[model samples]
Target: MKSNQTYAITLVEYAYGPAFSNAMVYSGYYEMTGTTAVEYVIGVIEGPSGILLVDCGYDPQHEVAGRESRAQNHIKYQHPTKVLKKAGFNPEDVSGILLTHLHWDHADCLECFPNAKIYVQKDELFGWIETLSMPKEYNTLKVSVDICDIKECINALGEDRLVLLDGSVEDLFPGIDITVAPNGHSWAGSLITVNTKDGKYTFTGDTAYVKDNILGGRHDGVSMPNGYNCGSVKNVLITMQDILRLAQGDMNKVLISHDIGVWDCFESITTPEDDLRIAYVAK
Candidate 1:
């Protein structure tokens, strides 16, 4: 018989970024006026063994490539260590990290968690490494590769702290399983599905930017893909459909990492100042 275990998942907002409305939705026509800024978050899974972090939020000083130009007006960043502490977790307490991809914002803070082993899709790591080896100008024009962040991951691998996945769905802890996104937002993004008292929750890292990306379509019951897809748009649509199917059609179970609306669905904790907030804590 299969053992029934449950874990609690929390969404910790560490940074904020601008998102274009027209870019987020799928429409044949383009409207370049309105934009909605969204939050950058990391998922925390608390289980029987220990705490597992989905993605490490970017370090405030990493100088996110294109973001620098608009940094003054569009970006608001916080160090992951401080953010995790505010959420009641110490950086060193994280037992493992389930990286969706090797993007700078998601993987740059790996060094903060000294005791945790990092988990990533094998293809994602190799593809990123190969891209990094290309001529700087060519790779910069073709891809959003962050050499510094990639080097940090490489150092972790050298230290025997990296765990590579062969693109298979497997249990990371008692009630948490990691599933591969058909074609990643980047190369090979991964999703974390956790069984909680409420239901099954899948942390979709950039695969689906917002809830609408998975539910919005031309037809009433169809699903759509996000505007930004580095891999394949076709794969984005297929991945959205798969996530909905895995959630058994319950949209609430599909937790989107960058959706600000997520705060409304969960019980959130925030200070009176309202500048910081932690969403979805088990009561």
Candidate 2:
């Protein structure tokens, strides 16, 4: 794949926003709680020709901290500033954004990348408003960062920046593809497939909290919202079926947006000098 093109991938740390107490740990999600750790990250895909972000990490201020903060949108916005500087770039230097669902953590700071084009699942964007009422779409009150609500996106981005693509996707870039999985955590949930040196990596934004959920076959349309469960049992069934196909083991490797372990698949370098020798990132 390196021979196919010259590019770099950056996994910048953002907010570390979750609070895990006893009950959470007792329930087997000890990692989701306590002072152990929290992480919010966004993936930067850079080819010799372009710069694209996997998702927009959240805004960490208290005002946006309510439910949006539940997943612990782990962040250190300074991570962006620092990573960019070390890479000889800046926030404004980003040229494109591929929003993975509109949850605040993944969509809040889009304004920072004013010069980019934002790509998303077309159905996911429209579904945000219409699907909340559908049992299959699940309650999106918390996940809905619909294009219209952000106001900033509307005011600064205009509709062009928000291109919604639904269903199976073609080559999004030289080696990447966008496949919107309609399993119910949110209306237009998308799973991003990136063709990397190691293999194909699929980034699932909240489709599941941990890779096990996907391994457990959760995307079959029966997906339960993280920290909330508005999904229909019916949705879970279909999503599970979808995972079965992917799990076949060559098509892709699933990376959950909230999974701390899966992050290891990517290598993290403190400076640009570390360069693009690996496929994934980690803390």
Candidate 3:
């Protein structure tokens, strides 16, 4: 098993269109991939590292309010086993889990890989507490985000692998880095980068609802299409500062968790080294 083997990722799922409706005015958010599939990337890092998973999508068994809730749209999952099986992997075979942020969609499913180390932004675990009691004007969910999953992450990996690093620094890994681009999008949002062939791949987890938000370098504001607290221009700007650091252009590729246009950009082929990265399609 070569750790330096070509790293790969897959768009396990992609959702498009307006979501989190209540967030529209405040967030200035238009495109919402709310009820969408959870994207997972199966990477075969350097020698025998087995595999690393970033942002495990929602579990099929977990059910919430239907798409009508605006918060919960047409959420769908391709079954974790199916996604991993595509790469000849099983949950137990995974080595690590790096959750960009624990919004219900991203971190709730950690139990899937009970055997892997869970890495996250140290500040993000309780990042939402500050605004948990704020008024609706903040677009706050006030749903009392469950920390049980995070605790599970700590226990599974012995609290050692439950890593919390600077979201503004790099070198988290040989070809990896994360920046805490806080837009109050969902808790302490983060921007992830995976260095690839020539440049790096940017994973903007819900920090922005769509690709244009980061690509164009503009905060579309906070959107709560889900009846939660819609975001504000000021907070979104703070998030912008973090995302811009990652850069999403000639030098990088932007992966929006819910953008259908962004998702379609990648091929559907399955494998540990899935086709999810900066591409040079002819203009």
Q: Give each model's whole-structure lDDT.
A: 0.73, 0.55, 0.52
Per-residue lDDT tens digits of candidate 1, residues 147-237?
A: 6767777788899988888875656666777778755477788877888888788878887666766766434655556554567777877
Q: What is the lDDT of residue 170 in candidate 1?
A: 52
Q: Which stretches of candidate 1 lie above 4 Å from their native place?
A: 1-3, 18-21, 24-32, 65-72, 136-143, 217-222, 281-283
Task: List residue ranges in candidate 3 displaced over 4 A.
Answer: 1-6, 14-50, 63-76, 128-140, 157-159, 215-232, 241-245, 270-283
Q: Please provide, for model 2 over 246-271, each residue's C-alpha lDDT reduced to its tens digit, 9 standing for 90 to 100.
A: 44543236655555554456554433
* Model number with the top TM-score: 1
What are the RMSDs of all candidates, in order?
Answer: 2.6, 6.2, 6.5
Error of 1 at 28 (Å): 7.0
Candidate 2 scores a C-alpha RMSD against the true structure in Å of 6.2
Give lDDT for model 3. Answer: 0.52
Model 1 — TM-score against the truth? 0.89
Question: Model 3, range 118-197, lDDT digits (tens) per residue?
Answer: 87766666555555446777543644244445556667557466766555666466556667755455555567676655
What value does the lDDT take at residue 32 in candidate 3? 38
**Which of the two candidates, 2 or 3, achieves a greater TM-score against the reference?**
2
What's the CA RMSD of model 1 in angstroms? 2.6
